[model samples]
Target: MSRIPRLTPARAALAGDAAAAQAAAAPAHDADIPVDPQAGAFFDCDNTIMQGAAIFYLGRGLYKRKFFSSRELARFAWQQAWFRVNGAEHAGHMADAKASALSIVQGHRVTDLEEICEEVFDEYMADKIWPGTRALVQMHLEAGQRTWLVTAAPQEAAKVIAGRLGMTGALGTVAEAVNGVYTGRLVGDTLHGPAKAEAVRALAAKEGLDLSRCAAYSDSSNDIPMLSLVGHPYVINPDADLRRHAREQGWRIRDFRTGRKAARVGIPAAAGLGAAAGGTAAAVAMYRKRH
Candidate 1:
């Protein structure tokens, strides 16, 4: 049997001194760590792992660095706002927001983007995690589950977070690049909605995983397809629509936003997610107001 690995948000982060220590300590940072079929848990990023979208976190960092004009930031913010609120039902909004996010990175070096994401994560995202979600990741990890971050966020950001949290690896939207230079386009469709389900399936096939026995978790209604693809589908901090859907479909639900930190986890036992929506509170406020 493959041995279980240590996959928790490095204790330093959990202790509140998080940021630079975790990333620098993870050796599996950018590599694609293979998953073992016997045990695996696929987690959606953004609101599921962290408190908000990784791209929004990255965008704010870029804006502070003067990487883009205020006008461009405004435009991106608008698209992101629409995406955050209506994305579950409006596929078009996410597409537009993703396109704009990719365009913002066009002409930038992949290496530079990595550095930026790292810095952004260190100073911002590392501490913005939802504790309940972290607990879930820990549950899977301690049980020998190869937890993977499945998100529409860029691979760099996803990998950074996964590595910091000591997860197996990440499957995210791939931006086309050559010789370390971005091609200003995606290699394929952004890994969102149905694409997310497809990515998980492809990964499962490669990892020899039986999808029927695996677990998946997410906060958006847009992830319904991905959620449905697994045996244990958890609706974490679900939006209203997703909450309603979970009730109707008899899916397990955990709402950290309004309820007490989620108790009674899957296995091995762990504390629930704490409310850290305030860590990324500023950006989230903007998204809420814009919508």
Candidate 2:
């Protein structure tokens, strides 16, 4: 495991508040690209649309429902606290988080889990949505383009969010189920990093949309692949690494925390690309939609 760097009190609080502030803000960045009705707009669920991570809330609900033991909750909480204050302790920490989340839902009825999601969502998740992102999603839908929530969150919860938001649907990490009961085993790799990109490509193929005409919005570096898969990529409330990446790659970047209304492209693109590729700093996760 890699050592997490110490954070000053101010920095830690700012990191935590960034997502919520973003969610409550008005839509500042407008993606004024050529709209193609046949194409899709893919939005990353966590951080991108939601104020923070949904997994944290899911784990909390599971704990309250006694799905996991007290000790397990303590350990999970400690890990989460560590991750929040410090970022991933190890490179595999994200993988571990993914696995543990799947395990948390193992053996639960899919329908039951969906109901729980609804409860969790209603109790709190509903308010966590970033209104700015929702506006963009609505824009895509109103334009007759398919809008989907692409997320690392479980498909059940992701579907719930998409349905609630009136999106076309969702593409999310699948957990295997038998007889409508979860098997606690994933169907494939956790949809992060390169896997996200692959999922978008498959979806694009299925939808018969031109890749260049599609748009993707994300905040995490893990979703870089997904963002790059589309021609119109927007980085929203971006982590430092992703913001740097976007700047370098000439992708449109939006920082809702700032007063910037439009994405700077031409000059910033060339300038950002001229800089060196920075290290993959452990990013503060924006928990949201639990979607």
Candidate 3:
């Protein structure tokens, strides 16, 4: 098995870090050092492992079940598209998506949501996963390293995706529940930006992981904080902002989206389909409001 290598964030910011990291990863005597038990791999779900947003996928599933109206779906799509275009999340967009999602699940049983998420993953998300990113995840698992998914989607949905992918677990936004039903409220802030970093730190503490030996992968610049906390930071299928940041930081980058359309839009290939399904240009109004 390949060893889980280490590279400090301070060094990684330097141009020479790439060569240094590669050299450190494969030594003269490969068998002398084994993968560290304390090493872990943390990946952002949206656009990193999957092609688009997990919340958007969950919303689409709920819409199919008549949990929400067409208008609501349109609005959700707009928020997600706006996020994709900007390469980071907007506070207002997140609030709207969170409120809409929580409201739909307010009186529903948690088990029902889990079941729906499972079906959604099989139908909508299974094939949408980026092959390159999935390969990296498999590599980590093969190396005996624990792998976790960090996302802003509901904890249940995130758990379902992680379980399906055979990952260790997930860290996601927690919605309050009572008597097995959603309460239409969140336990704390949504897992985005600095919140993602906090979640990673807490998970590392609980899992006894050494941040200096761990790795983090994401597509958005919003994940910089979380990426900075790890020894190996990789930007996968990065958005424009993240692409720029990754270059500046000298971080490793992997883009799985193919062809000119993906290059032109600087987003996942599924985004065009998502936008079309969300309602044409009418939803652009919703995107404007959030900005």
Worst 10 residues of 2 by lDDT: 274-283
Top of the candidates by lDDT:
3
> Model 1 RMSD to the real structure?
7.6
The models' CA-based lDDT, in order, is 0.69, 0.64, 0.71
lDDT of 3 by residue, 244-270 (tens): 988998887767665222223232111
Question: After superposition, which runs of candidate 3 have C-alpha atoms over 4 Å from their true positions?
Answer: 1-35, 81-88, 259-291
Error of 1 at 108 (Å): 1.4
Evaluate model 2: give its lDDT.
Answer: 0.64
Which lDDT tens digits does candidate 1 get at residues 87-180? 3334665566677778778888999988998899978787668766765664455444577999988888888888777788899888999888
**TM-score for candidate 3:** 0.76
Better of 2 and 3 by lDDT: 3
Which segments of candidate 1 are over 4 A away from where they belong?
Answer: 1-13, 17-37, 78-90, 259-291
Q: How many residue pairs clash in each candidate?
A: 4, 7, 0
Q: What is the lDDT of residue 199 in candidate 2?
A: 88
Candidate 2 C-alpha lDDT tens digits along 1-291: 112122121122223353542332222112232334457788887777876666666777778888988877786676656654432223366566677888888888999999998787766577777645655564454334577888887887888787666677888889999999998899997777788899889988888878787888888888887887777888887887887898999877755444333222111111111111111111112121221
Q: Give candidate 3's root-mean-square deviation (CA, Å).
A: 13.3
List candidate 2 segments past 4 Å from native: 1-37, 78-91, 258-291
Error of 1 at 249 (Å): 1.9
TM-scores of the candidates in the order shown: 0.78, 0.73, 0.76
Best by TM-score: 1
